[model samples]
Target chain A: MGPPWWQAKFRGCGYRITIAREVILNTLAKTEDHLSAEDIYNHIHTKHPNIGLTTIYRTLDVLTNLGLVYRFDFGDKRARYELAEGPKGAHHHHHLVCTGCNRVVDYTDFIDAEVRLLQEIEQVLSKKYGFKITNHLIQFYGLCSRCQADG
Target chain B: MGPPWWQAKFRGCGYRITIAREVILNTLAKTEDHLSAEDIYNHIHTKHPNIGLTTIYRTLDVLTNLGLVYRFDFGDKRARYELAEGPKGAHHHHHLVCTGCNRVVDYTDFIDAEVRLLQEIEQVLSKKYGFKITNHLIQFYGLCSRCQADG
Candidate 1:
């Protein structure tokens, strides 16, 4: 892992690998939960008090634009983010968001049927609508086990 | 029909079916494409100039909260609104948004495999994570035929 793919991606896009950007990327890469900018700022504040919330927001915007991070809206008005390619490997996945608890589960256990269906749908839509299909975002919203149990 | 499902829903929730709300709902109900608050206001403004932008925004908020409308962010900063149950029958669908031209296509042609996979996944996720799944949002982002041809 020569400086990680994201660093290379930053360089490829002519973006500087500033400390703020690097820290933000590392934080998202290491954490499993979806985090808001304010949450991220809190996570980095004690260790990097100089890293302003504004910088985190701007860096997130840049990273999201570069496809290095994914911004999610779970109908909570606030945006949450997670790394596109995380420590969990290169396996692409969707999300199961707990609307009750704000917990997010990455659903990576893609069955053959699911994969085939997606590929087929892409082909069908592309042919039907003449779209050069690129990618997709899918999220299921509900109550997590703990939240249900609590209720 | 005595009243539309959404109108009943609003009444059930004790929200008055005011003209502003009714006009906003009618506008979204008739239009096929997604509209921002401004777009919706502009559309209604010509005929109903008395309906202010603030009222449009408020009604949209109310309608969205009532699950009568869906709010979408297509990677653009602007939010788009569409009826949850549109004039195209009760068929549930996803969206295919053009990254270039901001065109949105509703995909309702679900194959058996697609439907089965979703059902199976919901079951699996519910069992595996103890998530009582309620709903889902899925959108595919891509370039339309014209955009491809233009390039």
Candidate 2:
């Protein structure tokens, strides 16, 4: 299909659509699941060898700033990027990441409950500590079926 | 007066009691707050200027491996670390993090409900997709009072 909702969000965020951005966006869109910046760089490098690691980092930064992409740290040294603009927004989904094989699956069904709870937490924190909460991420780590079976 | 549950957990998990680990653990223990590695490193480094950034990273990795510390990625470059063990256990509490100032508050009232729901999710993921989830992290992010006031 076309670019995912997150790609469109980048545009909505007033980001200038450039070759590097498009390449990075397309790479993320096509991935079956989350990919690290290094993964993206290596994939794009084979075809567009001119692409620099700095450019990938910069584009990912822009996408994250625009709330168009989500960055996950599944204990990996490098952050992984995934399109945040699915049918639900970035905050709507949680991740189930396989530590054995490094696979990621998005769980979006609990958006309403999660959002409500988060709002309540925000209220409590603000009232008690006068701190403003913005966004958060939840991730579960475990083994995928194949890995579990292998183990 | 003593280490938080998580710090005790690290000791129980066979983690070495090194100066770096102790400094890091002490920092987290003293706070009812969540802090990024950089925050912990900076705070500790002030007292021990020779500690390297890599040591912070390594100490965090060890703590996480032992399930003594929890890592949070609130759309920030550096991940935040907090003591995970509570009166109940490491998995009993969820975190409320302030997006404005990066302050964290721990909440433990929802354990029963979360445990039930998480069991169901685990079953679904395991049955349908063959994913075995061992642990999960839930954090809610929002604007704290200071951010709200400044805004």
Q: Rate the local accuracy (lDDT) of all candidates.
A: 0.84, 0.73
lDDT of 2 by residue, B125-149 (tens): 6666668778877776777666677
For model 1, residues B1-151, the per-residue Cα lDDT tens digits are 5676567777788899888888998899888778999999999998999999999889888988888888888867788998886445446778899988888898886645666778778988989988999877778889999999999
Candidates, DockQ:
0.73, 0.55
For candidate 2, write residues A1-151 as lDDT tens digits: 6764455665666777788888898888777667888899899998999999999999898888777687777766678888766564344577788888777777765556656665665566556655555576666789998898888
Give the lowest summed-lDDT range of ten residues in model 2 chain A.
Answer: A84-93
The C-alpha local distance difference test score for the whole of candidate 1 amounts to 0.84
